[model samples]
Target: MSRNKQAKRPKLANEGFTGRLRFFVGRALLNIRQNAFVNIVTIGTITLAILIISLFMLVFVNLEGVANDWSKRVQVTAYFEQELAPEELATLKSRVLAIPGTDRVTYVSKEEAFKRFRERLKGQELLLEGITTDVLPSSVEISLKSASRNSDAVAVYVDRLKKVPGVTEVQHGEEWVRRYTTFMNFLRLAGLLLGSFLVLAVIFIVSNTIKLTIYSRKEELEILSLVGATRFFIKAPFLIEGILQGASGAGLALIILTGCYYAFLHNAGNFLSFNPAAAGLAFLPPVYSVGLFVSGVLLGFIGSATSLKRFVSV
Candidate 1:
């Protein structure tokens, strides 16, 4: 009899892990079904919070794309000394092209510059009536590579252009670039602060919901404890429940966001056609989409963990 009892001990211990896993899963489902109202409220709250945050992220990403597009359009106009010989012009072009980060260099003859000026003075042709091509200096328009179009990079290029022998003046719109950079920085900071608040709010709401669930199952938990069940066995079901709620809510939010994104794209097609950047707007990238889902799971797990710490002590 002693040997038989000893043999059963190892078997029971081996089965304990699988038994606990099954118990946690079954109880989690039972609790979700039994407290349908609370589960719905919790899931709805999470969905709303995540949806708002996702929308903000989409806008920020697209705004960043547009800013990059604008930066790429930035060009430096270097006016050259008039009446340069053909050989001097060729040498200047070669030297400018050799500069790092120079994407393209176009020589704008005096005649072309005067033509562009006349086009700008459309209705006010009198401004150019007495002006000749000689009055405007020939210039080399330098386009910087995308990576070199920032304020500091453009400033460096301006200094280099000034040192070039035949160049008289360089205009790269430094003030405008500064203002644009400042505005982008402000937007990013504001978005980060707002996103942090939204995540905290989600955690708070989830924690309270889990606490209520725990309170309602207080008697069951006490019974499990009295029957020699471990603390992990008692708390595992509630943790699983919290994870389910978060994942479900996130899935719903993704569905709704996708529908709205496509609807807006379809309806606003005409309006977006007017802007080049708007035409290329996109939903969240795949990496960010995966991140949003992972964030939801973590939020739920953390909320449940916090609630369990308080209730398990009892």
Candidate 2:
């Protein structure tokens, strides 16, 4: 190359921060081009790993949405043995609202309760023929906060409600809530374990793959070391290369994930749910997508650093 053409190869050992950054980016790109096959393999491996983890996240995200939807049904009803005056009812509503984890307080008069019962037993109107408003209890229906819908929190909330004056009894679906909470906890634990394992596996794979590139350029690194190059100068380009590979892998994985998600929806819409039109299939949320991208970048950074520790000590 002519001197006026300015090759970056001769300027590796010394540069300012900005110059160093430019050099690192150029070198990373150069390395990727020169070792195109190895870099492609590394990026492909990263993409596969990211895709698997993202698929798991998509399922888990949908499950969490279902859980939140069901949790909305977790209501606690405080029944009164005798009917209360209008003022008494107002006072009770205020007190319940003041309690922690109370999302809403709905007062159900005896007549309203009777009407609801009748609606539920629509065809069995005969069952309610003799029943009057006095036959049913008037109650304050307490809808819980999202965070307090779990069994333990609901139990504590019920205990507090029972202590309120005029409350004869408090009832929530204890057994159902207990079972649901157990299942949710188990799901979270399993996701955590599996997610952790996948992340570590990808990092390991990337590290080993990067090691191959390092081995191929062993002599070049040695020459840079003898020429008084800083360790960071030698490591920066490889680190940047890893970052690029990681980011590209994540982007490609997301593209593939989107394609698969649409394909699933297209086919499943014909037969999947009882109401296929409202099957509610969803992709990863924006927050989860951000997490995936960050995970990819992290995978690359840690992997490249690990591989460079023993091999590139300029």
Stretches off by above 4 angstroms in model 2 are 1-15, 274-277
Candidate 1, backbone clash total = 0
* Model 2 accuracy (lDDT, Cα): 0.86
Best candidate (score: lDDT): 2
Q: What RMSD value applies to candidate 1?
A: 4.4
Model 1: how far residue 105 lies from native, Å: 4.5
| TM-scores for candidates 1 onward, in order | 0.77, 0.90
Candidate 2 lDDT, 170-268, residue by residue in tens: 889899889888988998999899889977787777678778777777787788888888898788888898899889988889999989888877777
Error of 1 at 40 (Å): 1.6
Candidate 1's residue-wise lDDT over 282-314, tens digit each? 789988888888777776777778877776764
lDDT at position 306, candidate 1: 82
Report lDDT per candidate: 0.81, 0.86
Q: Against the true structure, candidate 1 has what lDDT? A: 0.81
The per-prediction CA RMSD against the true structure, in angstroms, equals: 4.4, 4.4
